[model samples]
Structure formats: C-alpha cells, structure tokens
Target: MVRATLGESSTSASVLCRSDKINWQARNKPTIYPKNFDLTDAERIGHPKQTNNGIYFGIRMGTVYGRLADIHNATFEYLRPQGGAEEPWRIGDFRGYNQAARITPIASELSTEIQCQAEQAFACRIVHNTNNNGGINLDEILTFMRQSGMDTFSLANAYPCLMLTRKGGTTHAVRALKCWDTRDVTPLYHNGAWHERYYIGMERGTLGDAAQLLPTTNGSWPLTVSVFLAGVLAGDHFDLHNWCLTNDGNPAWVLPQAIGLYDACGKSATYTVFDDSPSGGNESIWRVYVASLTQISTGIRFVINSNRNTSSTTYQLFVDVAGCGSNSKTFTMPQYSSTNLDFTWNELRMGPPAPAAGSTYNIRMQIHSMSGTSATTLWWEGQKTITIQ
Candidate 1:
C-alpha cells in the first residue's frame, strides 16, 4: 500500500524532496507559506472565506471596490441625468411640442366688418340756454358743423342775440359762442338758399317728378343753396332714371328760366351755368337738348343757376303740329316778327309718355331770316312750347 505525505509551511512534498527543503503539516492538512502561497481571508474575501494574513488582500480588494463604486456612480448619473452639463435635460423647451403633435396650430383667418348700430349716439352734441325758452342757437349749430368737419364755415352773423359754438382749438371740444338769445327768434323756414327748404308737391310723371330743392339753413329765406336729387344719396353709386341737380336763383328776384325735357336721361340734357355778374347779368343758362332720341329711353337735366331756385323740368311727351309722325319738317317764310306756330289737339298727335329703349324722337326746326342785309343773322332765343304726354 502506497501513501502520500502532505506538506506544512506550504511546501509541497514533491518540491521538498527535489529541493531537500523542510515541510510541515497541521493534523495531516497541507500548510502554505505566507510568501509563496496565500490562504483566503474572510475580512478580505467578505466573511465566507476566513483566514489569517488578510490585511494586504483586504487593502487590495478595498481599492478595487472603491474604483467600482466610482464607475457605478458615474454610469448611473450618465444614464439618468439630473441637470448639470454631464446630465443635460430639456424640460419646458420640448414640452410645448407635445401639444403641437396633437393638432396643427395653423388655420385660416375669417374676415369681419364693423357696423354702427342705430341707437349709437351721433357725433353731434347739443347745448342751449336753459334760462331762455328753447330758441335757435347759433353757437350750437356752429359747434355741430365744426365737429362734423366744417371748420372753415361761418354761421349767419346777422342773428346777433345768438349763441353759436364751433369746434376749435387743440382739443376741439364743442364750445359756446357767448351770444345771448334774449329775444324770441323765428327761423326763416323758406326762400331757397344754401341750406334752405321749399315745400312743393307735383305729379310723379310731371316736371315735378324730378326736382332738387336747395339746402335749408335756419329753414328760411332764399340764400345760396346747392341742391341734388336722386334715388341715391351723395357719393352713392348712380342709379337709373333718377338724379337731378339744380340751384336756387340769386337775390336778383328773377324767376329761373323753366326747363323742359324730352327723355328721362335725354341726350340734349340742359345744364344752366350762372355768371357771377355784378348785376346778376344773365342767369347763365345751359340746356342739353336731345338732338336725337335714338338708343335712349330717358333724358336728364342738371341746372345750377342759383341756390334759391332748386327746380327741374321734365317732358313726358313731344308732339309736332303735323298731326303725324314725320322725321323732318321745313318751311319757307316771308317775314319774321315773333312767328306764332301753334299745334291744336286735332293738328298734333303725341306718342307714349315713356318711350321704349332705342326709340328715336327726331325734331326738325326751320326758321327764316327776313331782315335782308347781305344775309343778316337772326338770333332765336325764346321759350318754345311743345305738347307732351
């Protein structure tokens, strides 16, 4: 029977035999030397492996654990960042994008307009002498007009005992003109003037069907008043067969020359022009005569003579003396002394009051010059009448 002997002092038996070294054993267990072989130390190997001589190994393991702890801390910080440069974060900057992802924030804008209500207060403000019974106040009117963008306007100064206010100064608040209306004042309600009023009623199809009265200031005596009449208001789009502009006569006390019409918007629409004559020389008169009523159903006339005479003349029909519809007329006269040519009911026939579109009214006028002086020229400027429907 062969038996093996273990070594003590950590010297193998085979090594001891070859080198002739001393060997030792503890209860037949092999022993390792401190320098050549190491026994596991529980302090260094963490409790399970307990042995002596573990200080040096404990130191080496402690160093490795420290390095591992540092690496773990760094790896944890890098994976789950906090806030520093090494742990960068995007909080609010990237949060808004979440809402954008749900829906696009782009949309078309709807158009709208502002409109004024009827109950909205008008710009005109009014003030009067509470002490005096309500009377015509100039200051109030002036202030209202000024606030309404009429800065360079003047009220009638003749009404001395009046309070007129106007918009002036930097702020331009309505102010009193400091005039006293101690006496009862009656506003002139008529006599065409700039801003004057006239009351007249005429048949719709008659000359009064289209009329333009003057503006009414104090609603009274004739003054320089410009007038315009139409289905639309000033600065409005033009309408068909409805617009007349006329002026009242001046203070010269002369009835304006009456105007007659051939169509609602006739080709020869007459417009009077007034010359600012010192003596009101000749009320400048211009008339647009319908040379031919071809391709027209209506004739219009605009006369601006004086502000006090806002009137219009419209003809519903035109009839000749031949009692028939003829395109031309001619006559040779022996003399001329205010020739009188009248058309009786039987001698003349009238057409429709309103002609159809493209209908024509051909007028032929013939006059003879009797005054012989190497072909003397005669001026025919007078009222000529024609029967109309």
Candidate 2:
C-alpha cells in the first residue's frame, strides 16, 4: 500500500510523479522567507501570514477591544474612517475628552453667622471644580450633610452646643445638627463657582449666650457693671432702668367737705379724704426718660414763674428718692395771686439743696403737695422753659 510521508528533519522520499505538499509543522517555523515552489506549503503559508500579521488582519476581543465611539464613527470595513480626517476613531484621544480628571474631587467648607440677639447658624459647602470650563446650575440643590464617625442629622437632633471645639486653627468643629440634615441646604451661586451648600443652626451656642458676662475695660457692648461681675456680687446690668426711672406727685386739697361737681344733668363727684388726712393728697405722676446718658450731677433744682393769677393757693413740695418719699416743705404764692390781672414778673426757685452733688437718679420726677385750698381755678401762664440745672 502507498502512504503519504512528511519530511522530518527529515529525510526526503523520491517520487516518480507530481505530489501535493501539506504543511504540518507545529513549531520552530521561520516567519519570513522567499516564495518558491521548492519550499513546502507550510513554510510558504508562514511567510505569507507574517507579512500581513497585525491587528488589522484579524481581530478578537482577546486581542483588541473596540470602543462604542469607534463603532459609532465607523464608515465601512475597507476604507478610511467615517469622519474622514476629522473623524478619527474615538477610542481615546479621538473624542477630545480630558483624561486628567473625569470626576472632580469634592472639597468641604464651614462658616458661622450670628443672627439677632445671639442666635447662630453654621454653613457648609461641597464644591465641584470644572477646571475653568465655566458651567452653572440654577436648580435648587439640598444635599444632606455627610460626615464620618458622628451622629446622623435629624429634625429632633439639632443640637446647638453639642461640640464647640476646634477643627483646626480658628475653625470650629462643624457638628451642628442643621448641617447634618436637609433642613438647611442653601442653593445660591456666586463668583462663578459650582457648589452645593448645607447649614447648621443653633439657638444658644454663641459666646454671648453661653459665657458669663465679664466686666470689660472697653465696655462698649455690655456697658454696665453687672456685665463685669457675676453672681449676687453686683446689681443687674439693666435692672435699675436708669439710675432708676420713676416719679410721684401728690396735691392735697384742705377742704374736708369741699366737693367739685359739674354736669349738664347734675352728676356729682366728691373728695373729703384730704380733710382728715391733709398729708394724703391727689397724687400726680411724671416720668423722666433717659437714653444712653449716664453722667452724675451734684443736685437737682426747680425754677418756675407766672404771668397772671386770680385766687390764693398754698402747697408743700418735696423730692422723691427712688420709689420712696421725703418730707414736704410749704410755700405760698402771695404776690402772684393778688388779682386776676397780676401780670408781674414774680419767680419762685427752690432746690440746689444740701450741697449734695454727683448723684444719678434712675427714672422719675416726684413732687408732694402737702396743703392747698382754692375757691376758683388757678392758672400760671408764661413763656416757660424747664431744663436740667
């Protein structure tokens, strides 16, 4: 029987007729050689395959990975790309995408604000940089705060003074409950930065609310002695209201049974209480208002005048200390009450008393009228001026 034989280092077999060559070598094959009939078919195929042996000849996922951008821009299998020169394969650099950073890194920020009457709010921010590409979003963004290793923010968990320590330098720790929740997110754009914000609010975490009032040298803020001293050692900073701001005046009519009644229908009113108790009189009040003035004076004085008078009247006057009373001093308007046309330049003066100086009153002007009686109405008419003397 005749059988096919392969050369194996291999010695050759002689043949009287033509024979077909089949390459069967599995190893140690040269990649480039001359094309000639003298070589075996296996050797010829190896050299031909080597000349065209790049990714273009044959492609598999194990060898080359084609991208969607490349396929999207592809034209035909056997020509230049679909986009011509401009449309290169968008596998990588072809799409013009920056490889520096696909997703921007996020930075955090925190700030504090003092509202009216020592209220407080802390603001937090998450910033995304576009590398100066300049883009903005006007949509309201409310991001809940995320911090590692701390209590989660909630409506019932807005702690004001939970942690007032330092984060670094003057930066206080951002542990406010408002910053932790979605309740305080602020959606605002400013200075061309892309960012989202969160807020932390506390009612009483400010220095003024938490710390005791310490007397300060400048005293610009507190402006009182109690702000400097604590406990029961000193008086209140605002309790005195001035020095003190109060006043009381009493006018006693000596007619034990005298009653003044006037009515179209004869409705009457009576006052006989001052008859038995002449010291007890009709009390009138006046208030002395002071604003931001705290200077002390030596003493207070009183000066008054009248242009004309009709009837006679006598009364006693006295000063009031704080809310307490003082003894009365009597006086009479004899010259001024001579007639209804008593238009004389008669003036009465009192006070500047006791060489007492440098006293500050909190808030009142008090006068006590001990005794007086009149059958008709009395009027003191003049161009009057009263001032601190």
Candidate 3:
C-alpha cells in the first residue's frame, strides 16, 4: 500500500501544497491512511478533522490539511490550558488561542490604571478645588454634613472609603477602605497608620498671649474697639436700670424690672406691676411675661390698690399662667373704696398643673369691675414673686 507522508514531511513537498496533497491522497487511496478515520475516534483522541463543506469534529490541529486562509478562518472549540490544572473550554477562531490565560494579567493592569485615575479625579475634585477659587473647606464640608442631619458621631461611625494623597509636602498615598469608630473618643487612621489629633486641648496661654495673636489688619482695630465699647455700654446700662428699679420707681422700666428680678431669682419667680389709673377705665390687661421654673410648691400673690375715684364696685382679678401647662385664678373683690387688697394663689387652686424644671411659663394678669363697671377702675396692680420652697 502506498502511504503519504504526514505532518511536516507532507508540507515540505514542493510539487503540491499540503491541502492539495492531502485531497489527492484521500481520493486516490482505498482507505484514508489514519486507521479508516472516524469523527468519534477523533474527539476521544483529542484530534479533530475538517471534512466535507467546512464541517468539523472534536479538536482541530494541523493534521487534516486545508487552505491556510480557510483553516485560519474555521471556528474551533476546545479546552485551553490555563496555569492551574483545570483547563477552561472555549470556542473561537484561530486568533483567540489561549484567550483565558490573557484575562488576569490584563485585568490586573487595568485595575491599577483605574485606581490611579480615580485618585487623580478625587484630588482634582476635593483638594485642588477646596484650596483654589474659594471652594469648600473642611469646616464647611463638616457644616454641610451636619445640616444634612449627619453629626460628628455619624461621620465617625461611617465606613467611608477614601484615597488620600497629599500634595505640596511629603507626597504619599493612603487608602482607607473601612476604618472609623466614633463613640465618646477614638483615634483616626490613615492607611492603617494612626493619625494623631484632638478635639479639645488645654494649652497654656494668657490674655496678653491671645491678644498678640490677633490679626493686625487696619479694620480689625476699629472692629475690636466697637465690639468692646458696645459690650461695656450694654452691661453698664443693664446694671443701672436693674439697680434703679430695685430702689426707685420707673413705669417705663416695669417689664424690664420684672424680667431682671425674675432672672436674679434663678428664673423661679414671676414679677409684674401695672398702673391702670392712666387709662381710668374698667378693665386692665397686662402683657404676658415668660418665666422659667422648677417642679416645686409655688404660689402667686398680687397687691391691688384701689383709687379713691373707684366707686362702689366689685373688682375681679384674673391671673393666667401658661407653659408646659395652663393655670388660671380669679379673685372676687367686694365693694371697696381706696383700700389695699391682697390676693394669694396656692398651687392647689391653680389649673392645669405646675411645670417641670427648665420649662417656660407665661404669666398674664387682668382686672375688671364686676358691678358698676363704668365708674370702677383699678388704680394699681402689682405681682410679688411666687414663693418656691
């Protein structure tokens, strides 16, 4: 039996190209040289053959000769060996040999480039923009976060990823993936290294030392002087007015006196004095004063002085306190002429209820004549501090 040389020997023959020779050999021979070839055997043996109309079976190697361009264009599917033991099977044309092996290296390179680009973008957006063009500062960013309902604690608790790069100094890059713990007190970290800082520190300094640190701009001096003088004048006037009310009488200073006395008494008292004689009318209503108090046994007292002109009439006085709760008292004054009337309201008689500590309380007073309303008028109305013991 005449046999044709295979592989490199068949390709080396100058008279005919490999494809033409293989075709001539197959047609001329009684049986193909390679054991009466079968597609199943080709697959099992890791060799595939292309035959009749571009059909392929199993893996394709250089065994079955064809046009070089046709062989290159023909699609083949087989397992390509990777670094590990298991090879991954894939399908593609000749150009895609060992495609899976190329993936990881390319991916690693791309990942590094992407990370660098991300860092550059972050620096441009945050550091460069912040330092130039009056962009946001760290304080402003913190303020915005707070306004958006994020507190320092929240920020500290957050797992924010940051790629930090310092410019203009010792250049370095830090990547903080997820590192922050803000509860009471904790240290900060940059790329696994502890960052030292303090929210509050007590450093030795004096008033003169602080004064020396003040900016020496021309406008600063006038601003400082104006603020100092305004504060001094305000303090002096406040003291003088309060002192005068505690000693003498000033109708224009009545509310200020009440507030000043109330504040001096630890905000536990409500004081008000009104002279209704100027209007010479039947009704007198005073403005409300807000006071603060603790939850304690308290009482309100009023001094009512009737003018001689107040005819035979019954006067009704009302005291209203509103705050965490509401309370009101009405006093009945029988016919009286030029007489001093005293009324007291203990906690039991008041309504709704006494307020908790630090709660604001509003006090309002009103006086009117019940009988003979036209002729009767209240000469003076005064509020004494409620006893809180």
Candidate 4:
C-alpha cells in the first residue's frame, strides 16, 4: 500500500494543517509498517501464512478517539440528573460522541445505574469512521481490510466494517454485522470486557492473546479532543449556547455562562463534585457581572435536588445587580429537615419594579462559601435559575 505524510508523521496534521509547513518537495521515504497489530492463526499443525506477516484472520484496527459529550438530564430525573464531566471528547467525529456517566447513591445504597457513555459505548458496538482525515492512517487500515477480503465499505466508500480488536488497556472484540443499523443497538453492561461469543460461523473464529503491546500508527497517547454528536447530521449546527455548563467540579473560578441558556433556574447544565479540593475546605462559585444593552435582568433562585445531605448545609448565596435599587441581595441557605429535604427553593431578589425591556441592566451572583465536608453535595450553579427578560 502507498501512503504519504509530509516532514514528520508525528500526527495526522490534516486536521490542524499548516499550509507553509507542507513539504511538497520532500522525497518519498519508506512505508513504515504499524507496530500495534496482534494477529494470530487457527493453530495449523504447521507454521503461519507467508503473506502480510501471518495476519491471516484480521488487521489491526488503527485508533479510536472518544470521551463523554454533553448529556441532557431528562425532566424525569429528580436526583443526580446531568452527566458530570467537562466533555473531553470534543473531537469532530462519532468517536468523540462517546458517552460517560456517574454512579452515586440516590436515596439508598443500592448502587444504581449511571451507565456512562463508555459502558454503553463498547456494549452497543459503536461504528467508527473510515475517513483517513486527522491522522488515522486510513491508507494502511484500508489496505489490510481490503486485502483480507473484509472491507465492506458503503457505496460512497466510507462506512466499512465496524469490527476491530483493541490492543492497549483492554482488547475488545465485537462481532461484525453484515450491515450497519443504529436502531438495533442495545444497552449491554454485563461485564467490563465483552467479546464475541461465536466468531464467524457456528464455531469460534479466533481467541485473542493474553497480553501484548505493539505501538503503531501516528496516533498519540491521551488523544486529541475530538467533539461528536450521534444524531446531529453531517452539516448540522449545534450552537455554543446549547452547552450551558456552570461547573465541571474543577478548582478554578466558575466562569459565567456567556451565551448561557438559562431561565429562573441557575444554569442549563451541572456537574457533580465532592469538594475536589482539600476535605472540609470551603468552595465558592461565581457569575461574573454582565450588562445587557436592551433587556431586563432579575435576580436568581436556588433549587435543591432530593439527593442533598440530610445533615443540613449552608451557602452564603448572594446576587449583585449593578443598576437595581438594592444592588446586593443575600439569601442564606436554610437547613434541610426531614420534611424539607426534597425540593428546597429559595429566592435572591433584586427588589424588583421590573427593569424596562428596552433599558440597560447588569447582574452578578456570588456564593461566599459552601461547606465541602459532606460526600453528598449540591452544586449551586446548576440548581439555581437566573430570571431575565
């Protein structure tokens, strides 16, 4: 197979190409083979096949990049709803759309299901794109698949066999489908490693090796951030405002949701944190003050989910409206009682007479401190709503 890469094959630079860095006049070097292939045979009484380095059954599946994309908390979710993570899988492909989830005790210690996108990812057999862009070394991958008579790409020459064996941390082997179908995917988290029970025919295909490591391809470790969305089409528009994240449970100051999609509730999104900081240390959240040219901005309201600790906690929650009569309004969080632990809603008003719709207005929010000692926590940003017109 003939493959081409300029200067250095550090990474598939097609995604973030530098026009001037193109070594168009560079000489054709060597077709260095991939090092990650771990192919085996059906245990013939004799030796291995003489062709393609004894890779008689299958070729190494180059690389797959992924992470949990944004997850919407269904309206029915009363406890820990939104998936908690900053969305590390933001690469522009289906692999990046891989899911993630959290497993937390809701009311009892029953170990409920948080089926992270990862668990469901391998279970459902997610299909990977064969497009060689972004350094995936498609030339080599395609060559092996085609030569082995396993290449079943579509008419457009894109979607090929979604089946491949992973090598590194875990070696996952899923059965190949005669054709692709999204609706047929099922949720299977029975075990961490799910391999095909029966390989090709009624009998088994090939069993994998115990533990092997062969580093091949131009792909790097801790992969590049590739964003993805399953349903969003080839050229669909997913506005930045659609991802209204308040906090990713990081130690840094929370930035204001600029194009934040919000209502009376705090933010459209939220993540979980058990005081990622020092135990018992205090934590604070912020909403940088902002002024609108033509809109009325009211104060914010705080809503507590059912999963909050029974041992009542306090947050010195306050809001600052730049142009309002009472520029500052503080609402101390009331403790949770047996009767009030479920839906505790409190308001921090800007002493309203309503800002004129066409007039200018500015607003801000601050949580002086929220005790981070408890394992069962509440994120102020996600639970509160900002009222603005």
Candidate 5:
C-alpha cells in the first residue's frame, strides 16, 4: 500500500530518495507477535478460546530500492506459519491483483445463494403488489416479510429510495435493488429507521449499508404491466437512450433502460443519446445523442437486462445506428430476455461512425416484442455523465 504519487509539476529532486546510496538503519521499535495459536482440550474446556476476538494478520508497507551488489546469486526463502494445519481445508492462499484484487481464507462462509434467495423473495413481493395494484401496500409487505422470518431487508439508498415521496406520506420504508438479471427497480416505503432488524435477513440488504438506492416508483404501480429496462455502466452513469417495455403491469417508469458510457468508477462519462419517444406510440423511434468527446475507460461495460417483464411473452434486443441515417449498421442483440441478461460491448464500436478518442456518438435500440405492442414504460438515454475515476 505504498503510494508513489508523481505530479505534473514535480521534478526529479522532489523524490524522497537521493543517489541510490546504501544505508541500513534500525530505530528503537517495539517487537510485535502473532496472535493466532492452537487450542488444546484443557484450554477449550476450562478457559475456552474466545472466538469473538477471531484471528488476525499483519500488513507491512515499504519501498524496495535497487542494491549495488547481488546477494549470493538468488537465494530462496521458505516461510511458513506456526500452529496451523497444513491441509488446504484448514488453511489456503488466495490472491488477486489489479482490478480484481481479493483474498479470502476458507474460514469465510459464503451466503450468496442464501442472500439471493432472500432478494428473490423480496422481488416477488413487489411483483405481487404490482399485479394486484395497491392491494399489497408497503406496510403489509414489511409486516408480512418480518413475520415470515426475515431479519432485515436491504433497500436502494439513491434518489428513488426515498420511499416517503412515493407512498404519498405512507409510514414505511422500501426501495429497489438494480439487478444485473432484472430491471433497475424502485420500491416504496416511509418513516423507517436505519438499524439492524431480525425476523428477516434485512440486516444484509440495508441501503447504503447493503447496496445503492434508486428513484421512486411510478404511477399506480401496476403489477401486470410493462417492464422498464435501465442500462448503466458501473456506479451511477444511467443510460438515457433506448428503453424496452414488457407486460409486467408495473408503472411505466419503474425500470428505465438507459444508454451511456462510463469510466472506472461506474459514473457516466459519455453522453448517452436516448430515443425519447413516447412509450407504446406506433412508428415512433428514438436515438441517443453523443454530444462531445468523452474519455471512457478502456474496458467500458455495457449491461443490458430485462426489467419487470412478468408476462409470459418473449422479449429480445436490437441495436441500430440512428444518428447517421435509418439504415446504417443495424445489429440486434442476442436473445437476452431469459429472466435477466447482461451484455457488454465496446463503446467505441457502438459509438457514432468515425469516432475518435474522447469523442461522442448516438446509438439507438429496439427491444423487440414477440407479439403486438405490449406497453412501454421507461425510456432514457445519455442523461447523466459518468465521472472518470
């Protein structure tokens, strides 16, 4: 974790080191010890090892400089931990670097499936409410889920997570989780406290505490209605152009399908040219407007998924070059409507014709409906610009 920052105005003299001189110095520092050890039967029975403290490790941050001479060719050092089992089941090594730096010991338990099931249950509640109108209000959902053995329910904490405004002053709290497999959602609620709750696993899904928040719900909150698909980079740059609709009975804007380029921070960096045509209008088409040259990271991610398409009808994705003309480079996305789909493409290729570094373009899409017009709801393009990391 040694950060070497080089400024544009910095000169060679600004560096902390000088002339590569050799120096070995030791100060009066106290010695440190490893805290982990084996537990004997007597120690476990009489004075049981407290698991609350848990095990610990150390991290040393330093700078390595070139030496004047070599040390006996290349000597190898074999280091091993004491008082630990040698088997992989008891101990193992994990390492990740660069964009995917991560490490975890076997002691860590994985709750992805459990939490996913919880998230699915929560989503089902919303789907039920959407299908049955206001029949399943926010309060009823909270109470029922709590009674059903939920410790907590995580909600999105962003703009749409403000359940108060959407519920018309209802006393409850609710928000939606933007899923990679489903539409970016906007749940409802109000007057909710921020803390750990039992009965449900909500302690794992708290907004800001668990995940990001979204905007409020749309009108009527129809369950058996259209599905809104919103596309985003990583953090917050929402795509503004080209949205898709399906018969989910949910509000039109519940899930918005946006289009835009983003930087490393998941912030919108490129202008997402959106086809802002009215939903369900016959023969209406829209295109995203890339206004200027925007610097997007090399591995810009383009995600596409189905949102709130509760109906049994099949849905698909199609891309077309709308800026230059009606029929330029028309490309349809592969069948991406199985539950939810994630598609990543080169924004440069998807950019306007003859795109340059730090430039912009307009790309449009058509979420093909199997039968007739099911009903369109959300539509957004390059509304927000992703911040470069």
Candidate 6:
C-alpha cells in the first residue's frame, strides 16, 4: 500500500510518498499562481460558473459576481477587444441593472404594434412615410388630424381652452372658436411668431351677436356676455350694430346712419321777424318756431341770431319751452346795426322734465322790447333743438 501526506505551508506543498519499505519526502511542490488573463483565456479555463446564486468569474484576485447576488456593490474592469485599453465599470454605472430598461429605436426598428400602443397612450395620430427619406412633417400630421374629425378650430369651440404640444416641442394654444384663412396664401407673422394661413376664431360675444339677446327656452341662462381685447393697439376702431326688438318679438337691425339725430340744427326750425315799434311795448312781437323735440336726458340747446338795434334799447328773450322750467334772459341791443348778437345757453340746474322715448315736446323763443323811446326796429332769428346720443 502507498501513503501520501501533504504539508501545511501556503507557498509550498510537501507530499510524503511511502510504499512498503521505500519512504520519500517530495518538498517544494510547485503551487499554481493566479495572473491577469484576457477574457479569451478566462473563458478557455471554464470561468463564469454559477455559484452561490450568482454568476461568478475566477480572476487573479478573487471571484467576481454579476446580478444573481450582491450585484449592487460589484465593480469590474473590462478590456477593449481591439483598442487594447481597460475601462473600469461598476454596477452603479448601469444604475444597478444588468440591462437598460429603455433604448432609443431607429425608424426601421419601430414596429406596428408599438406604434399603435403609443398612439393609444398619447391620444395622438401619427403620419409617416416609409418610402420617403424625409423626416416627419408636422403640417401633414395636422392635416391628417383635421381630416379625421379632430379639427383644431372646432376643438376650441368645444373645449373653450386647450393646449396641444407637438412631437418637436412646438406648442399651440386655442384662442378662438372660428378659424379663417388669410387672404395672402402665405402664413402670417404676428407678435414675432410665424403662424399658418389661418386666423383663430374670436371668443363669442366679443364682436356682438343678436342671438345673445334672445331668451333661453330652458335651463339657466347667461345674462351677460363679456368682451375681451387681447393685445389691441390704439386707434383700432370696431363697428357695432344696434339690435332692437320688433313688434313680433323678433330682432331688427338699425343701421348707424338710419338713427334719427336731435342735434342743435337737427330737427330744428328757424323763424325771422322784424319789429318796428315805439318803446315801452311789453308785448312780444315775434314768436320763434318751436323745433320738433324728442326725449332728452340733458337740457336742450338753442342758437339765437339777433341784429344790434339802436343804442339804449333793451331786448328781453324768454325761453318758454315745455319740459323746461320757466327761465328768462335780457340783453341790450348793440349800437351798430351790422353787428349781430349770438346767444347760447345750457341749463344744468332745474333738470329737464323726463320724457318717454319717442315722445315730442315744444320749445319756443319770444322777444319783447323792455324800453326804447325812439322808433327802433329789431331783426331776430332763433333755433332750438337737443342732442341725441
């Protein structure tokens, strides 16, 4: 029988071979040492074995583990196959994952199923041309959406306010309910931004609508309509129309020019009279014609033209118009006959009597000689009217 005994030294191993009468001690048994090896060499030696619930590699220092267990704290260095360079890599470099969860896909890599899933998740429709080499066109996508019943203009009317962002990070906000094409076939530039040849619809009631005055048939009604002017410049004029109710509860349009005027000269009549009589005559000689009057919130306006008669002659004018409290004014005749005296008055106190709309009143002017010794003739002309808004 042969017997073999091993030594305890780490650097060397001593094997004692004994058989029958022959005894021998083999000292300094060579020990296998670990050395830096290339991946090809390691693989040749049957590395990357499953051990302790982990993929481990027997390297120069110790075993290296991947995933399966304690991967969070593992660090490793990899050699470039052709570059002949080593790069240190750690589990943290890959965010503690063995593989990437997401990866950018090329155009050819996008599958039909993935595209459909993306469309369903994002609520967006995409248009692509596999035959063409050009990139995606946003304008074409918008056209597709519009054709598919997702009209951008109508969207504003339905949602009132909506914001949409495109794939290229371009964003658009719905500002109006209607969209109009521009007269110029090209796009328009507004506020430093270029826009397509379409105008966003204005908010309802901003430009006024006759339908706003109509009463609702059911449910709560909106009593007021608001107008908003966004970024409007000065001197911008807006034409408005007046909607009036007809006898049959229908709306009637009144043109701006068709409205009746009630200015000083409007709807006014003038009268001229020559009074040649001796002084001391208290009776009024000429009565000015009364103008066709209408409802007036403010006091009335009058224009009087009178020739300057002989000096020392006093002329008294009385405004005996209806709806105006009794008021009298006196003035002395001018010395020169060529000089005419013009008088105007706006009565603020004793507010004019409130009159119903379309109602008529009479406004008259009378002139009398207070005192004059010689025979003096007075030529007087007067007009009366009121201003309408």
Winning model by lDDT: 6
Q: Give the TM-score of candidate 5.
A: 0.22
TM-score of each: 0.15, 0.16, 0.18, 0.23, 0.22, 0.18
Model 1 error, position 266 (Å): 24
Ranking by TM-score: 4, 5, 6, 3, 2, 1
Task: State the lDDT of candidate 3 residue by residue for 1-389, as single tens digits.
Answer: 01133223332212222122222111011111122222232232221232321111222212112211111112322322221122221111111112112100000000100010001111000110122222112233333334544323222222211211111122111111211112112223334544221111011121223222222322221100000000010132232111011111211221110000000001111123432221454111222211122233344444443211122545565555543223333344422212333323334334334433444345555554444434244422343233233
- The models' CA-based lDDT, in order, is 0.20, 0.22, 0.23, 0.22, 0.23, 0.24
Q: Ranking by lDDT, best first?
A: 6, 3, 5, 4, 2, 1
Please provide, for model 6 over 1-389, each residue's C-alpha lDDT reduced to its tens digit, 9 standing for 90 to 100: 11222222222111211111111111111112122232331232122222221211221111212211111112322111111122121111111111112110001111111010001000111112222222222233224334544323211111111111122221111121111122111212333444321211111232234233222233232221111111111112211211111222222321111101010101112232222222675221212111122333454434232212123456665555466445655666543222232222245223334444454444455555565543233323333443333
Candidate 5 lDDT score at position 255: 24
How many residue pairs clash (N, CA or C atoms closer than 3 angstroms) in each of the candidate models, in the order given?
52, 11, 1, 15, 67, 2
Estimate candidate 2's alpha-carbon lDDT, on a 0 to 1 scale: 0.22
Per-residue lDDT of 107-223 in model 4, one digit per residue for the tens?
111111111111111111122222312222223433444555553421122211112222222332222211111211111111242211110100111222411211122222121
Q: Which ten residues in a row have the lowest lDDT in candidate 2?
A: 223-232
lDDT score for residue 100 of model 3: 19
Report clash pairs, candidate 3.
326-352
Q: Number of clashing pairs, model 4?
A: 15
**TM-score top scorer:** 4
- TM-score of candidate 3 on Cα atoms, chains taken together: 0.18
Of models 3 and 5, which has the larger TM-score? 5
Cand. 1 TM to true fold: 0.15
lDDT of 1 by residue, 15-105 (tens): 3222212111111111222222223322112212222211121111111111111211111000111233322332211111111111000
- Model 2 spans with C-alpha error above 4 angstroms: 1-113, 132-181, 184-195, 205-389
- lDDT by residue for model 2 over 1-389, one digit each (tens)? 11122222322222201112211111111112333223342332222232222111011001101221111111211111222232222221112212121111222323221222222323333333334221111010001111221113221211121123221112112121222222322122323432243333333323332322211122222211000000111132212111111111212211111111111111012111100111453111111110011212433333321111123445333323342233333455442221111111111122333222443333222222233332222111111122332
